[model samples]
Target: MASEPQYRALFLGAGPQMQCGVGQFTRLLGEWIEKAEPGSCTTLTLTRSEGSFTEIWGAVGSARSVVCNFPIVAWKRVMFTPLLAMAMARLRRRKTVLIQHEWAGLHWLRRITYIPALLLANTIVMFSPLVRRELAEDSLVGWTAKKCVLAPLPPNIEAPAGMAASDLRRRLVAARQDGRLVIGHFGSIYPAKQPNALLEIGAILKQRGLRPLIVYVGSFIRGTDNVEEEFHARATELGIADDVIVSGFVASDHEVFGLFGAVDGFCYPLDEGLTARRSSVLACVQAGRPLIVTGPALPDEFDHHARFKELIDRGAIVLVPRGSSADAYADGIVAALKRPPVQAAFDFDGWWQDVANAVRAQL
Candidate 1:
């Protein structure tokens, strides 16, 4: 009789373009698996194209053992996902795992593609309680109640503690010494992110006798789209174009941290459309920087000063309601910037380890 195939673990959504929380979580999970099981387990990454595929393959090759699973596609069309799933099913034995992210949809016809994999998977990892609720509501897990596990998202990169609080304070003071209050925003540039709202807030700050220097770091997510162009135009219209510095995509975490260090405060003015926890907020917490967030109100748990609740409280972070006018957001930013800095300790490493252990438990 033929011997049964060796049990190998597959990470379904590992790609180079995957830069969000889900990607970070999957990569760290793979690393932990290597450390825990050594050569006994393997990670299978699905890629979209061949170009630069070798680079990613090499990066992951350092793993104790991993495999690259690429599906050729005529375009970015997702029709290939079903075929890929079918192929994966054939290659899979023992048990496989499937990790779901925000975009995992559940249309009846569309569900046909990944439904088989979901049913066959020994474990399914979900990133948030919201995701778990969605899955439970859909009843997509079938009778495999034991297979689902809630795993919190992971940070993209480990945060570095390079600047002391005194040094950071000095940098902020220096930036403000020239009569301009340096307010920084970092993250992807997109309409849903509400970059234009920052420009409007700058105008409001100017009206309040505060000269605002706005700095945006990070490249536009979808290219030179109309939304970004309009955002720039709004700044120009406000006559604060010179005060606004659009630093397109700083690669170094230190450089990003320096920007945070230099700024009086950080602003995140996302619209109500976004639902995921803000990674930028996590970065701010790790960097020990205060924030001026304008959008849907954060949960009450974020209101406490030491705990996660305090991070989102109106006391710690200035919260503006979603759809609030640019002027209202600007007023909130000015008020937040004027408040004295509050020192708080955050355990980023501990957070990652806890999340990793949760994923390990399910595996």
Candidate 2:
């Protein structure tokens, strides 16, 4: 075999040990990039609140020596804008790619502090066109759009295993003794994630004669652990406590994929519209389960993305308006259930290849 071409690229982001979505993305994407271009890609993990800015500077300086040296230095976490600004000033000779994960994190109060740093970066990678548009509307940062790259977030988890990989499917089926359809919501629970909407969906389904069990496959966000308790309380108030299942954080991606296989469909309701930054959405797509996503308006750009449009064309994802009446939500779910499993439409590996190419091209 031709020796894997050697190249080195620097990544500044959270590592796998951080246990958060950005960290997971950084870890998995870095590994995938290296696999695609062997011996390429080095990462300088971001400092948690516990570490000093000076310490991070030391790490960045050390990582710059790697030969996969490219003109672009990609930074994944935008929350560290100040540090990013300082780093950019020091590494002025190199280009930078700033990947923004959350729309809210770009709030003026927080963002204003880093506006100068953001504009200085070579490329602004926004996960969704809406976010990119929103950023463009901002007077201080709108000009950054000249260099913005719209790369949809790709699924990062291992592909879903065959039914024989686990007994989860059988167990879920058995749990639904009355032929209940179990709908799942994966990823950490947070207000924006809309776990409460699942209750409304379940109630609507029940009234329509299809028993629905809402399963939460991930844990509540830290500092909001009580959110799970509140969910149960709300479910009880709605008189469907037994139908709601909360499975705290699962460590193994295989098990996570197994849970995805167990569900009849994956329901994600978010106010932000289905953006590319959502790894949970990516997970559902990889699971190949019918997807029901409730969000605000679907941007025209979404249709422009060939990959996402293909997923929709294959009946893999169904979009419902955010805050739609329970009847509307229930109707979407029923329609999604009638669709067959999308076994072959997804291009999981192709996404990694694209990511690798982008990194190389930028470098």
Clashes of 2: 1
Model 1 lowest lDDT segment of ten: 65-74
lDDT of 2: 0.64
Give the TM-scores of the predictions, in the order they appear.
0.69, 0.79
Tell me, by TM-score, which candidate is best: 2
Candidate 2: which pairs clash? 8-68
Candidate 2 ranges with C-alpha deviation above 4 Å: 1-8, 13-16, 46-92, 105-120, 139-143, 160-171, 223-230, 295-298, 321-323
Listed per candidate, the RMSD to the true structure in angstroms reads: 6.8, 5.7
lDDT of 2 by residue, 289-363 (tens): 888886535456464356766676677778787667778878888887786667875677887666656555555
1-363 per-residue lDDT for model 1 (tens digits): 644434334444445644554455566666665566665455444554532434433323333212211211111333354234433443433234456543233334435555555555556665544444455666555455356665555445556667434443455567678778888887767665778878878888887888788888676765335877787788889899877877786666776776677777778776542233455666765555567675443342222113344455535555677777777777776676667767766666655665556665654
Q: What is the lDDT of residue 243 in candidate 1?
A: 76
Q: Which TM-score value belongs to model 2? A: 0.79
